[model samples]
Target: MTSITRLFDFPYYQQDKYISIPDALVTKQNGVWVKTSTEEYISKANAVSRALLRMGVKKDDKIAIISTNNRTEWNIMDIGVLQTGSQTIPIYPTISEDDYEYILNHSGAIYCFVSDIEVLRKINLIRNKIPNVLEVYSFNAIEGCKNWVELLKIGEDETNQYLVEEQKNKVQTEDLATIIYTSGTTGKPKGVMLSHRNIVSNVLNSAPRIPFEAGKSRALSFLPICHIFERMILYLYQYYGVSVYFGESIDKISDNIKEVKPTVITAVPRLLEKVYDKIYAKGTELTGIKKKLFFWAIDLGLRYEPYGANGVWYELQLKLARKLIFSKWKEGLGGNLDLMVSGSAALQTRLARVFAAAEIPVMEGYGLTETSPVISVNDMRNKGFKVGTVGKVIDGVSVKIAEDGEILCKGPNIMMGYYKDEKLTSEVIIDDYFHTGDIGEIDAEGFLRITDRKKEMFKTSGGKYIAPQLIENTMKQSRFIEQIMVIGDGQKMPAAFIQPNFDFVKEWAKIHKIEIGTTNEEITADPKVIARIQEEINRLNDKFGNWEKIKRFELTADIWSIEGGHLTPTLKLKRKIVMEKYIDLFHKIYN
Candidate 1:
């Protein structure tokens, strides 16, 4: 067992761990044959810095990077930009042409590093719109773009190390490091400017909350590094010399986890749900005693609690079950895992509690891009670790409850401001406090429970308001629901558009002798499918008020994905886009 004393220090656990210009980034190379140690990372980064100088990149210039996750390439390019005193803008691989145009033009990025065909195509399509962009470097051997190897060859030349050192001398904590653009739920995206201090300070603050054992610690990174949660973790790893292993693709995270044997890695709720679904799928394949034991263990895990006292016999049984049953769960996650940190969206407390009880503690964190990502996190070691609360505020931060019960935070981790958005920035950031749009109540123990997003709470025509996220999370527990959006404002009652988990539904169909005929149209129209979805919807309605419940619903045959423009790059529901796309369904339900 890990020591409680080591895991936390009062006032949001921190370490004196310092990072500097001379610090080497820990990375892995292209072939998986090369592990770039911290020393090698610095050298390669300086070389890439030289290449940027040769490409005419200057201090304070914006350098856009378009890439899938590549450790060496991303770091060198990232640190290379930093070494030259220029800022890097890392765009998500899943982003669209319109967003690509807006970010490129808005940030005035002069150079972009493209790693894949799609990113290059996006840059090519938006070339005219982004007039200031001059150079494009591809990390892969794509035609018509300058190859990454060529840049590395020049980076290895050492001709500009003098120039690199010259540029590095000018870098400081107060300087704007990068501009992460958060797409608006309503209007245009706003660029959040985070300083070097903001990034580094958060890295330092978050260290003690996690389990880290020098060279032994590793992470399988799959989340979009463009998002600040993952991005700040990247910096945390860089500064602390933690080994970060990049997953080949979203498809390979499980297999890669086994290869990396990561001690800990961060995730959002959607990914965790998939992991749970996989375990459930495997359990279905077993039979008789095996199936019974598998199911019994799972049911126990679902209802397990760590905070309360239990009988010695029950505790011992749980311990034995964890070894015989749940240890494989960790082994599947690369065996060496100490924790799984979850954030960005609300993690259902039920999910968080189960994982923790199973020995795979999900340290649910809460924050936004505007706060350099991390604000509050649950330390598994903390005695008062509440199931539903998002833990206490992290070190070097002050959280206050506003008169309206809105959670307001003032911290070094808060962003400099929304770039070029003086009006919005002024409204949100008042008197050095970042006004988080979340309605939350802090308990006597100082743990914060998020009631809802302020903007998401909407009143009905009769004036009773409801928090949609709360309803949405509860509804998602249904096996049939792959996604859901609760719509109400101005209506007498709330209704929902539910996206059924087609894969699970198909499994049920197979068992029930329902003939799907290998086509989506037949399967969706099947009475079994409709009946199954309705059953789950009715089950979820038990917790909600009559008006707040999903009074009516529609299930679409089509799936919502990043490519489909239904979900955002971060796997968050694009509420506006999804509702507008299915206006007819809502209209029919309302009418």
Candidate 2:
């Protein structure tokens, strides 16, 4: 830690130090992760830079990537482009056609390093329309595109001294590193222009607060690095020399965890929630006594606090409970997850609490793409790990509540502005303080808790403001409901649009002899199924007033997913899209 005279003087040299970040690479050779030291990384990065120059990449040019978690190729291209004083444009593999087109056109990327031919097919859909794209490079052996191995071979003259000089002099701290487009569920994806300072500043500012150790902590990355939440952490890992293992996919994350045994990783709330559901699913498959104790241990972890009620013996029992029950969860996470930091969305407090009680530190943070994606994070060493709040602002960041209740932030982490969209940029970033759309309040201890989005708040016909997220969080506590969206912008009372946990409902239906071969529409329309869902909704509505209570509800057969057009890449509901698409059903319910 550098000695600073005042507490607020931290993060002063992050941008300066990032220019000095060591060039180290972690490569996968023969299935074993090998650490290529700083010298080797620079050599490889220089080689890649030489390759890009040979490919006619110019200064301030844009390079695009379409892949999941291939850190090898992703980082190489990222650093290689930066070495040429160029920007990298990353597109999420799961982004819709609208966002993909917006990112390509918005980023002004002239060349692309696509992962395979499938992505090329997507590019071919609108390639003629996108005039900026000059060439496309594929990572694997694709028939029509330039291959990765072949591209690297082009710059194979490792003795190219000019490439080395290019790495040293061409890049600067304030140069554009990446032009990230945010997946705005309500509107079009906006390209967030991040400079080397914006991203490196975020890494240096956040890395210390997180529990990380060079050559000690490893991470299994399955989360899409196209977003800043993952990209910032990726840079933080590079800065700290934390080895990263790319999980084959979401399905293989558990198997990879056992193999890599990572000490730290980051995730969104949905992934963690699924893990919790799986544990219970596995528990239900066990024999009588074991199953009973499994559920008992989990129930205890969820309900019990760190401080025991009945003194030493009770505390000892709780310890036994942890060893017997929750230890498997710790093992499931590769037996060494010191902390799992969640961002990009709000984490349910109940889930966060249970994970913390299980001895796995669940540090949830809050930020938007506009702030280089990190404004605040809970520290493992601090007492401010409140379940509801997104911790305090990182050491040097200044945060204040606006009169309208929007969270306003000012720091080095704040972005320069939205690229090419001056009118939209002016609406959010004012006088260097970025107005976060979320409505939040700082506690007496300075921890910030977001109530809901300022724009997400709606009104009933009676004109009483209703925050759907608050009710949705409360309703999600039930095991029966998997996903819920509350609606009542101009209606008499709020009503819920619900999706049930299919596996749970199907099993329950089978046990009750309620034949489950019906389609989603028929299943939701079934009298018995309707009664059960209504029972669950009514149980939740008991806690609310007539204005807030769900007056009518709907259970759809379809799952809300990124591919299904109901969710954003980050798993946030496209409320406007969903409402409009299902408007007829909503209207029929009220009529």
Q: Pick by TM-score: which candidate is best?
A: 1
Number of backbone collisions per candidate: 1, 0
Model 1, residue pairs in steric clash: 12-395
Candidate 2 per-residue C-alpha lDDT over 218-283 given as tens digits, one digit per residue, 9 for 90 to 100:
777778888889877877776565666766677777887888788888899888888888887888
Give candidate 1's TM-score. Answer: 0.93
Residue 181's lDDT in candidate 1: 87
RMSD of 2: 4.2
1-591 per-residue lDDT for model 1 (tens digits)? 211121011101112232222222333446463465555555666677888788788888999887776455786677767778889887887778898999889999988888789788888987888888887889878888887667678777786689887776677777888998885565677899988778777877887776666434667777878888887787666544566777777887887788778878889998888888788789889999888878777877777767555567667778877887788787788788878888988888778866776788888888989888788988877564678888888899889989998989998889999888899899999999999999999998889899898988888777888888999899887667888888888888887777778888888878888776566666667777777788888888899887677777777767878888788777888888888899998888889
Where does model 2 exceed 4 Å of error?
1-40, 304-314, 543-546
Please name the candidate that would achieve the greatest lDDT relative to the true structure: 1
lDDT of 2 at 144: 78
TM accuracy, model 2: 0.91
Consecutive 10-residue window with the lowest summed lDDT within model 2: 6-15
